[model samples]
Target: MINIPFNKPYLTGKELFYIEDAVKKGKISGNGYYTQLCQKYFESKYGFNKCLLTTSCTDALEMAAILIDIKEGDEVIMPSYTFVSTANAFVLRGAKIVFADSRLDHPGIDEDQLESLITSKTKAIVPVHYAGVACDMDKIMNLANQYGLYVIEDAAQAIDSFYTGKDGIKKALGSIGHLAAFSFHETKNIISGEGGMLAINDRKFAERAEIIWEKGTNRSAFFRGEVDKYGWVDIGSSFLPSEIIAAFLWAQLENLEDIQQVRIAHWENYHQKLQEWTSDNLIQLPVIPSYATNNGHMFYLICKNLKQRTTIIDNLKSEGILSVFHYISLHRSQFYKGKNFNTVLKQTDIFSDCLLRLPMYYELKVEDVIYKITEK
Candidate 1:
């Protein structure tokens, strides 16, 4: 039986050459030559004010939490239909997480409901670009400005995605947020085994970001000779990734356009083939808003309910294909149970029960997609 995985890291041939070069240079630690190259690529390509590669997206989110200065009892609003790290990062900073519902058409947070949740204690809004689909940033950003709230975008799946605002200006997902996090995990469009980056869009947070990423020390200042000696300056952590991983990441970044095209083809093929199921009322294909550009990070189908989702998932697994579900609505998770301050998450519950992610990766072939769909 030849089984297809839900995802597999696609490698560009340049990885070994870069890794060997890094090894020959004898600098494998964080922020070395290859690391700098990767950072510069993102900065130039994405128009990010500053880009710092982290050990993982989880680490980058934590770094954003620290940079935002989320404090105890401060309320942070975010959609519950997100990876736990999105909420856990702020929660770790002693902030109270207020769950929000997803929009009916898209799984991102409902911007209309966001304003009503704002209060004097509200500190920030984290919007997860679910499956690389852009959230309604125009509404979210306007609300953030109105309420004086910080916006941290969880763009784990939105590396190549774009949004055209109401004013006719096009912006990349990570660039629009005050601060954003990206993942290059094996399961993502790009791969570094386990890696991520923090995109600092706000100038005010740039300098402090380097120090915070380097374990709350002025080590970055010392390296640049801005200071005579480096020592602990504030609260921080070792969030930076190694140069070896950066070397691997550089290979992917070099061929990003080619990789994106391949994945986009696969995504569109799935959508085109499965669109008829919508009429049958068997499942709903992914809904991409008009303002968003496809990045080919994921392709999912919405089953009628949890029961149908479970049945489909099991059926796929039995057929030697792996399918999966997403976040379980953190507000209702075991860890958050009994927390009185949590808000109702109607859409989050619906998303959790209905959404099912299909196999999607840079190397997924058209035949494999056809096979999976035909099994239905």
Candidate 2:
């Protein structure tokens, strides 16, 4: 029997070639030729003002925190149903996390419930594009405008996604927010083992972003010959990733279109075959609002409750298929058990219990997906 993995990194066969090129070129450190090539590819392809590859998505979020100056007592509004890195980055800066609920139909922050949470203490809003689906960016931007708060998109799953506004203006997910973070983790649609990038959309933060990425020094400027000598100027960390990882990522980026097509085909197969379950009220499928474009990052099914979800998970495991649940809401975690919040997150609780992600990867065949759902 063959075991189906929940996620797997798909190599495009250029990894070794690029890695060998990096080694032969004698620059395996961060920001080498391959790294610059990957950065330029993202900047040109996505229209991002600047992109810096980091060690991980966690590191990218931490960089965004520094760029935004998240400080003590500042409040960062975000959904509770997200990876801890989404909240941990700000929390580490002594900022208070104001967790919001998810929307009923989507695993994104409820825009309607966002306004009342804003106060003078609110410094930013971190919107996670769960499952590569775009959030309500227009409403989020409008709210940010009204409150004078920064918007940092936790777009870990949202590379290559787009949002078409009601006014018919189309914008890429990471390009709209003041700052955004993307992951190229092996579990994602793209893979670089454990790599991520920070997308700086706001022009004002471009130069400072480079400094922040380079251990808070003016070294980048010095290396560019803008300064005769460089030294530490502000607080920063070693957020940059190695050239080897960047080389691997560049290969993935070069084959982005082809990989995306394969994953999208697999995603559609899951949806089409599972339509019967939805029609019979046995399970709920992932919902893509009309305004957003799918990026094929995740495919999930919502069971009636936690028990049913557990049953399905065990059943799938028995059949040698790996499926999983995600995101125990941070608000309910034992660490924050006694903390207070503005409002109850009803939808987040529902999603935390009911949602189950099926196996999705570039290599997953349509027949394999059909077999998983249609068998028993």
Candidate 3:
């Protein structure tokens, strides 16, 4: 009898209402009323050069890969301790993935080691803002500028997250990178069942992003009366989401601040209460770097080792509480093992085995979760 599950999709009570509105509006397909509303909100709020809602973060990333012209033998750098889509998006375009290790104190890519991974073939750097915690974007951006490479922020888990640079300019995670992808999947801070958006911070990608988003056509311009006829003008796909998804997301977005506050409170509760317990047990709580702002998208702990982590999970399960692990080292994955991706990333491997995510959601019982983890 599992009392606590790993995740529960949250509803804002307006999801179905907006979804129904989308259905009744007779424009439930891509780029309709709800889709424009959601995209405009992201742009206005975050200062994205342009925003295009997609069916999933994966599709947004794929569009990014296309926009950046990732070709065969072109190398893309990213952390190995990331979801496969981070790498797969480029791999599909025939770009070679050069995996980087995670930081010693955080699951984010080790910025210090990023320079070593770059080469003549390196075309782009994809930084995964794991757990909605912003990666050191200033460092990553500086590197990208130095190398004339594109910075595509894989901000799948990062919604309402920010980073403060040394200059004291606080920028939204997706807004800082040249191009960024965001998720509104059920497990994210925001929910739309399955949806994402591409934030084009570079104005250059704006025109083509819509073209690719509309399946290689200038249909968007045509719809705007910018063109007389729309036809296949470039290589692209149907990457945009339906108005139904956009409507559901719009409801969630309208209540984002409330949802964020509740989740952050739970995250703070977990961190504050587990401090002594984690220290005494040789476990490490999640580390929020000073430059990054917590979006409360996740609450995870790093146990001493694989054995300790497994034991904790098993014990939690026996107590009817649920905890889960995260990504494996993409460099060590079976699919890439035969692709000469034999890089040994020590920190990435450790996180793959030891990091454990606790139950976190809008309606989570913070006290119940705290008592179960601490009492055990």
Candidate 4:
């Protein structure tokens, strides 16, 4: 039996070199040379007004919630078929979560039904770009504008993905919304062991975002001599990542193009190989909209039902090939059961039951994954 793990972190060969250089700089703390390099790389590459590296995407989202001033009784609308962090960030700030359903074609939030979910209390809309595929940003952004709501894009899996609006201008995923969050987890396309970033596109939040990232202090401004001294200024936590993680991330950024090409090839291979299964209605493949570009973050199949998915997982385990299911619907979660959500998210529940993520990583051979997945 050939053993294949679900994910393996990739190293770009320069991680250690950059980390050693960071150590030699005599500053391994949060906002050091390497940290600035990683932040600048994203701001320049994605055209974001500002970027700040965080310890995790959760922290980034929390910072977004803070920047937007989510308050008690405020309602935040987002898909139920997302990681808990998406909702938790706002919930922690005392906002009420309005659970939205997933699209029938994809696991992203159902854009068509968003208007019906909004109320006077709706303060923001968080669109999660599942599987690195861009959500319908034009529609989502239009809704936000009409309703006077902030848009915080949950771009954890969408570092390099893009969306082309009706104006025919292509915008990076994180650059479209008022704010966005990204992840560089070990399982992500870009690995830094554990890291994330906050992209602030709306200039209004620029200064405050930096202060929030630096533990609610004006330290960042103080460092640039904009202030005489740094002190506790606002409500915040230690959100910035240390220089070592940023050093590792910079090495990955240096090789991003090469890495993206390989991942795209692997993603295409899976789509082609699984066509027959998908055509037979045995499972459903990922869907990419015309306005959106794929970032090759993940390739997943939707099983017909929970039992079939379970059988498939068991078969893969028997073959020594590891496959896994994704998130559960937050609306139906144990934590949400006692809460006051009246929404019936059928599509979200279906995805929670059926979606399965196959083994995907930078180093894994496409042919090996195809063979294991298609084996009778």
- Score every model by TM-score: 0.97, 0.97, 0.99, 0.98
TM-score of 4: 0.98
How well does candidate 2 match the true structure in TM-score terms? 0.97
**Per-candidate count of clashing residue pairs (backbone under 3 Å):** 0, 0, 0, 0
Question: How far out, in Å, is residue 125 in model 2?
Answer: 0.6
lDDT score, candidate 3, position 192: 89
**lDDT per residue (tens digit) for residues 1-376 in model 2:** 4388888779999999999999999989998898899899989988899999999999999999988998899999999999999998998999999999999999899988899889889999999999999999999999999889999999999989999987899888899889999998899888899999999999999899898899999888998899999999988889999899999998898899998988888888889888986667578999999999998899998888999899888888888788899999898887666665544688999999999999998777657656766666
Query: Ranking by TM-score, best first?
Result: 3, 4, 2, 1
Give the runs in model 3 whose Cα sits over 4 Å from its true position. Answer: none
**Deviation (Å) of 170 in candidate 1:** 0.7
Candidate number of the best TM-score: 3
How much lDDT does each candidate structure score?
0.90, 0.90, 0.92, 0.92
Higher lDDT: candidate 1 or 4? Answer: 4
Listed per candidate, the RMSD to the true structure in angstroms reads 1.4, 1.3, 0.8, 1.1
Consecutive 10-residue window with the lowest summed lDDT within model 2: 335-344
- TM-score of candidate 1 against the unseen true structure: 0.97
Candidate 4 clash pair list: none
